[model samples]
Target chain A: MNKLMMPIRGDFVAPRFDLATEILIVQYNNGTLLGEPKTIIMDRASDEGLCQMIVEEHITSLVCNGIEELHYNFLLWKKVNVLDGIIGNWQTALEKILDGTLQQGAVLYPDEREASSYESK
Target chain B: MFTPDIKSLLEGIPCPAMILDHIFRIIDMNRLMEAMCGHVTDEVRGIHSELVLRSNVGNSRDRLFKSVMETGEPVSTEGDILNCYRRKIPVHYHISPLSNSENVRSGLLVVAEVLHVEEIKKEQSNKSFSSAGIIGYSPKMQQVFNKIPLISQTDASALITGETGTGKDKIAEIIHNHSPRARFPFIKINCGALPADLLESELFGHTKGAFTGATRNKAGMFKLADRGTLFLTEIGDMPLQLQVKLLSVLDDKRFYPIGGEQIISVDVRIIAATHRSLREQVKKKMFREDLFYRLNVLYIHLPPLRERDVDIRYLLDHFLNKFMTGLGRNIAGFTSEAMETLLGYKYPGNVRELSNIIEYAVNMCKKKKVGLEHLPGYIFEPVADSPVAAGDDEINHINHQTSQPQERPPSLVVLPEKTPESWSDIERQMIIDTLKKHNSSRKLAASDLEWTRMKLWRKMKKYGLLP
Candidate 1:
């Protein structure tokens, strides 16, 4: 089972990791959901606290937008795969990530024409 | 939910900052920088900083990015930028490497601190005019100072010869800043660092499809520094073939860009500097004699710091005060033994070495005075016949100059010297003192420090400051 956490702003991923306040934790296996996603709202964004939560919760992978090099290195050092600079809806990103089609720096905006254009590329 | 695009993010920033790609093309800039340009950030995206910035850019040949990549260290430099209104803003910018976990060259984050024109004038109001932060009191230094304004009045191709770390680069900048072409770009490039082909591209730029990586038409340093100064450092080490190309540019104020049809004419003042003796290099057939003669129209040689009497003590005190202010420490004058070690040491590295030593001492010193223990290990290690052994007269002179008998500056009120503990014991004491003064109110303590409640909470948690 692959356990992933996405720091979401709303329908889309937060534009930045240090500024994110809400996160969703979900478990899946082979492109199918293993459990209902759990949402945790933070009082304020803290890279330190978030790193601790990722470690304590045993998150196998992380999906977020922009991340500083230090935090990214720390997560990688802890063996957690990080997908950063993703500009897309959380649901669409989840589907793509599950099917192993999501790129690390993907920009999958909600606009169908734009998203389809990226797909064509 | 407001998802911020680049435009929105840039608009929100109050200070001047820009996102630049690896090639030094600005990808996006904040509203503050945009306002200075009198154009929107989107309009100027992908433009070179030399074109966008209206100020004299001293090192215009993609220096910050290249240096950061070479050393993985951030670079900071001072220059004058002209905005759209033609108002000159003297800016000190730190170019930090912005990269993801994978690649180190994602982009560059340039954060600029603009200095007030009045402040610049006030800084120069001292009887001895100091330019580009290079100050001197000795006769030789004063002579160089006198020559600066005279050189600035004319468009002469000058050569500055000096030992490494003797502030030759600073002198070049001072000359350009005081020159008639001060309004235009003052670009510099080190011929010794990059390979000849890369240096050629940087100096003469390249047209699109000129080489494998040339994606767009790029303007060279000569073009960027048109009607301004171009500082060529370490000219002796410049490749022989490249020297001929450079000599051609010197003979005629025109250069052909790599893979370009047209010749670009430029009117640039060349101020070349080198630590090596060109005369010996010419005898050895290493440097071009004609190019050397061309660059040597006017000569200024910087004396090594060891030879400059009393300058050692003066520079030590100056750098001590500077580093102390930045670190918010009250490190007093050096102890007699420490003074002896510093004075007796033959500074092969010159002024730059002394500055580094003082900075190191300041950081290591947690006492009322910098002691011998705070100095670097090189002082203790026996070198080839180190200068005169510790003398009492020199100690007295340094102490007299460093520690003044007067109403001392209030901001640096000396506390009992204590070693910096993890998280710092002084900070814990301050937190406790502020909490007590505010009657145990965390909010008041947080506000007093200008820190958010969360930040204070974390600190309190770390130190167990609250019950």
Candidate 2:
């Protein structure tokens, strides 16, 4: 029952989503947010039916590679936990979640140390 | 009986029978026997059956015949015999000892049936196996069918770009089926089908304990499509991070499964397809530029169905045949009006959508021919019926453009606003009135509206046409 969620931004997600019809799924746990990182297809960039489906499915944590503002706000309004800015391999993001190292909310800046170390290099 | 008649009777017998003496010597033969032996000769008669079958008998024949004769059981042979004079022919020969009035055994009677070689070869050549599940006959499809062999000859990575339902997958299949590696498996994995992590494992097989769910070792699509083709449908949807990994695989031909140390290598041809403009996705920073450039090597842009209006009738007939047998129906075809209606609409879903529509229509159609009245109401409903509002906006825009008194716009300018009236108004007031004066339908409409029937229909629909 360790439900997880991950979002993928591009069509390159291992499991590609149909762009014409957006049908994406999110994962969650009991009261706690475990990133549900998954890819999905979309009819359009809209989330009218998607948000309701997520709430009905009782998804707690949504971990996606990216979510547009409209869908992001809709999920937030439903009180579903949202995690963003985690990138790289989808499983790696899930591992970070399991290890309790995944920072809550958006980590917009690519970590400070990693950025500074890159500058030095 | 006459000697010639007896000879003819012997030749007419289908069985290749021979007469033998007490010493098992050949006495007489028929024309069939001669043909079976490739030609009859005088040396062939009065010879022991052993000598005649010497070059043809099996290594175990003598034992079989001796045991049968000693036991007084009929010696039956079932095996192939290589006739020295003729070629090898499978023969079923039965030998029985002829008894005299005293019940003493005399000569053996041999009856053989030679199976023809040509008949078997003909049957084998005429055998028809079921076709693989690819289907299409439209001229556009015919062009694709023609391109399949050409695509197989090249080794470059191919990019299949087309609207959804354009049969990109079928195109990939055609390419693979015609390729040199057709015998190998053609693995397909939608880049957007799986989670990025699971997809990596799926593509490059994972070892046991590689991760929590990695119970046993698994082979990826690359392994399955080794030396064959890997069709990546919606490659445009691949995750950004995985895009980098995929790029690496394309360049180095190697990748490691999730949590696995060893890097596995595979030789698989990549054929990617997408409806979305990859250039737009790359600019949005959702797709990698390097990967797009890498995969965009050989681009094939399949034209949408709306672009090929001539193919509509061809596709309609093709689909009718496909679904008629499939649905267990004998519907004749589409009515002329239905054909005109179908040819008029701009199919947004392209071929796939058209197929679905036809399937729906076939299910709904009860009569022999599918007519316009039987068509889905949505098809006939103007675009104004939908929330898209594109039609209204375009009309208003045209009116605005036409109202500019500086220049007299073309006749089609006022077309949008004037066409929505009921068809009865048009037929009664415009068509019939004009026809009464001109005494001709075509000449009247042409002179009055300055347009043809096709153009009239366009005008009628623009005016909320009834008929």
Candidate 3:
């Protein structure tokens, strides 16, 4: 069984780890859901407090957007696998993590036509 | 809404360009920006700009974006942009407001230009003058820095003189840290903090049951600082009776604890500091002449922050960066008007006062830049036109004016009703008035004025007032 936590805003991952106030915690076993995911809302956004929650809850993995180096190092030191700089929908990122294909800095959004057009310019 | 015209405009820009909504959420970015930040536009289309750019400016990004949108003006600043790969690229950002066809505010257009490494190197070189966390580049401070090594080589009793906030204690610690006794503990005691009788017991130690409340046998500061450095701060406030005992200890390197029959000896180097003139204290029969000579064998005087004119701006930048990171606030810098006020104001409390002012301003400031309104009110208080003779009316007036409602009340001590030639005169007069108001009780005066007893004592010594 693996416990994963991801800071979320609406349907997408929160942009900044330090500014995240709502988090989604889910427990899964062998790429299958074991129970319903839980959501915790914090009174205020604090990186230190979030790190404490992750440790206290025994979260094995953290999927987020942007994170400062200090907090990233601290999470790593605690032996928590951190997948940072992941953009786009939280649902898509979660599916990728379940299938064991999510990578750091992954952009899971499907619509890349506009991006491709801009690149051709 | 991603319009064709805005998309074309972004593509036309040569440098990295991004369009942000009024709330600073990334709406779209050109291919250059995507390449620079290591993210595709579709993936971060609705994400906040700070998450993608991760600029060193921190939380100030929101304020800068809001300012541009509201004021319809372009704002520019220099900082590092941390991309997805955690690479820091020094860049200059220019942000301007984007309006709709009806001229109603809509969003923002941000352009980023990467700066050359040589430019960053030039700025850092100017900050090379620092030692042991003590930063100063002024000539006066340079002289003090030059003398530290020479003074640290000897075990002689040294005297350090400076105003209350001139970093005397830091200098003493730096000297001790660099000295041969760096391996040993460095102990410090403020002479002005305790009464003579209590100070005697604290310094020389007391036997169990020697006096009331002496429940256990205690090791004196001298014992704790064996083969180390003992720093005596506010030495001018050492009572006249205790001066003789201290003098004896310096000569014989031994002392008897109160009610102790055993002879205890300790080898400890003494470093004494005072905001007062020990020579003048000796002349007034308040300090012992022989003891003054013993402590003054090697003297180092620290000039006040005002005298080190060049250091003010340097220290301001240093403390700004310090507090910004500590508080997690992304303040770019002080507004020109705020900087002018800070530079022009007389720091009556010296470096300590300046540091406090900056901390307070940083906490109050909410925008990208700190403005004059964010500064403490005392900086703007009007100085008196002439020296009014000491009276109740003037004191009451000052108390009433400075008592204006604030998150932290300004000091209520009455200033000498005149454009005092020096800040010291104002501080001295204020201390005298506060002491008199509390019937000369140091504890009461300190409590009433929201200052530490040691701070009040140091100020009294600086003003040559008897405790």
Candidate 4:
């Protein structure tokens, strides 16, 4: 079984890790989810507090967007598999992560062609 | 919530434009808005406007966005917004209430004007507090930086006093570079490096046979610096006999070469520096009072690095970036624990020592981040327990085993079940083992450790291994 955490804003991944206050945690065995995903809302946004929670919860993986190198390195040192720079709906991102198809810098928005066009330029 | 007519209206706008529903969710955005926000229209459609805009002004609950929707009035303000990549961009935005054909308010229209975002980012990145290559932001350093230009315009003899490695020589060069005499030569002589007679001969020219070893006539530093600046470093170490000659030359702008009769006149600006207090030296009758008065006309003193509050962090990052580029290392930064250890250390050697420590750490770091193990062993040594007198500039010699009584307890040290082997112990053992393997040859040992001979020699001396 693996536990994954994603900092979220509404339906999408939060644009910045440090600014995120809402988190979604879920546990899965193989390709099947064991139970309902849990939502946790912090009183305020703090990268350090979030890191402490991640460690205490024993989260095996983290998916987020726009994380600073300091916290990223800290999480890496903690042995958490970090998939950063993800965008769009958290549900689709979670699905992709479960199937092992999601990669870092994945933009799951419906307008993939438009996002790619801007990125290329 | 966005009507086709409203979407078309947004597309007609010249600048970046978007429409938000009554709930503050983004309804639709024009192509220009998509480019500015680094997101496509479909990506952000129906999302909360705050999630997409990320304005510095609090959220949709803030007065700017809420007041516009509630009162049906337009609000124009200047602030910052985060793009899709989380980069803050300065902008001026106007939010106005949008109404249907029946005159019923449905949503709000927002138009943005980016205010030189790229230029503002560039300015912020380049806004380090520094002057003439000297990096310091403390009030004391700022006062010193402010005085450099004013003193540079004058020809008066200037005196600079600071602890060793506080960049006294760099300050002198900056003054000379900014002076009117910058076009001519800038010469420097260490007053403490030579003996009394040799120092005298170095200051004033000497004819052939001036001394037993003088086989040829040579120009002195004063002659070499004619019409320019002559920096006299470690001026307090100059012998008393030589001080009188320096005073005479400062007053008359003329001096005779040794073994020569005619006095040679030269126009030169004098900048003197010393780590010791000239006033204390005068009280002890070691330095001449008359010469001290002459050199103290324009004075500047640099505070030690430990006294600088925020500058330590700034210099750490500065030197880290510096050495990273020079060494071609991809090291990102120091770990949190390493940063804490570095910040807690009292740098007795001032800025120069901090720079050297960073260089050594960067060289030693193998991973992306510099860990506590990568730092030099000396930094972990405990500071002295003696209390420092307020306003005193002296540095107390650090005692490795003692704890500071007056200051807060050191952050990293605590009573433990078992004290781990300190980096100092590890380093000493490594040096000893390496030396034995190299057959006690310093050169071979240094090479094996990938350190310079001078570095190895200094380390050996620090460890009391010097025979």
Q: Find the candidate with the highest DockQ and give its number.
A: 3
Cα lDDT, model 3, residue B293: 87
Model 2, residue B284: distance off in Å is: 1.2
Q: RMSD in Å for candidate 1, one decimal?
A: 19.1
lDDT (tens digit, per residue) of candidate 4 on B337-448: 9999999887656677777778889989999999999998867978653243324332221111112222435553322111123344457778999999999987689889
What are the per-model C-alpha RMSD values against the true structure? 19.1, 28.7, 20.6, 22.9
Interface RMSD of candidate number 4: 12.6
DockQ, computed on Cα atoms, for candidate 2: 0.01
Looking at candidate 1 chain B, the ten consecutive residues that score lowest on lDDT are: B396-405
DockQ class, candidate 4: incorrect
Which pairs of residues clash in candidate 1, taking residues 3 or more apart in a chain or in different chains?
B54-B82, B55-B80, B55-B81, B55-B82
The sequence of per-residue lDDT tens digits that candidate 2 reaches over residues B1-467 is: 33344355556667765655444446666765654443363545543343334223433555555555567677777664433221234676666655545765544444463434333452364221113333445455455555655677786788877656666777787667656565456778777767788777768777889889776666677876777789998787888888988899999988887777888888889999876668777878999989988988876656556656677777778788888888899999999899888888766556766675677678789998998766666567543211122222322322232122223233311222112232334454675556556775543565587764334534444333321
Tens-digit lDDT string for candidate 3 (B1-467) = 66568788888888788987666667889987887677778777865566577566645656777788878888887876655544455688888888776776656555454543443552365533253457788887887877887898899999887666778889999889768676466888889888999889879989989999877677787887888899999898999999999999999999898889998999899999987767667778999989998998997877766667799998888888978998899999999999999988756466777777788788899999999999878778653322222222422322232221221324532222222423566677778888889898777887888875545655665564642
Go through the candidates in order and give each one's DockQ: 0.08, 0.01, 0.10, 0.04
Candidate 2 structure quality by residue, lDDT tens digits, A1-119: 44443433332111111111333353445435445444555546433444544655566666653343345544554456666433334445555665657764322222332221101
> What is the lDDT for A99 in model 2?
62
Cα lDDT computed for each candidate against the true fold:
0.71, 0.57, 0.75, 0.74
Q: What fraction of the reference interface contacts is present in each model, in order? A: 0.00, 0.00, 0.17, 0.06
Ranking by DockQ: 3, 1, 4, 2
- Chain B alone vs. reference chain B, TM-score for every model: 0.59, 0.54, 0.57, 0.58
lDDT of 4 at A51: 78
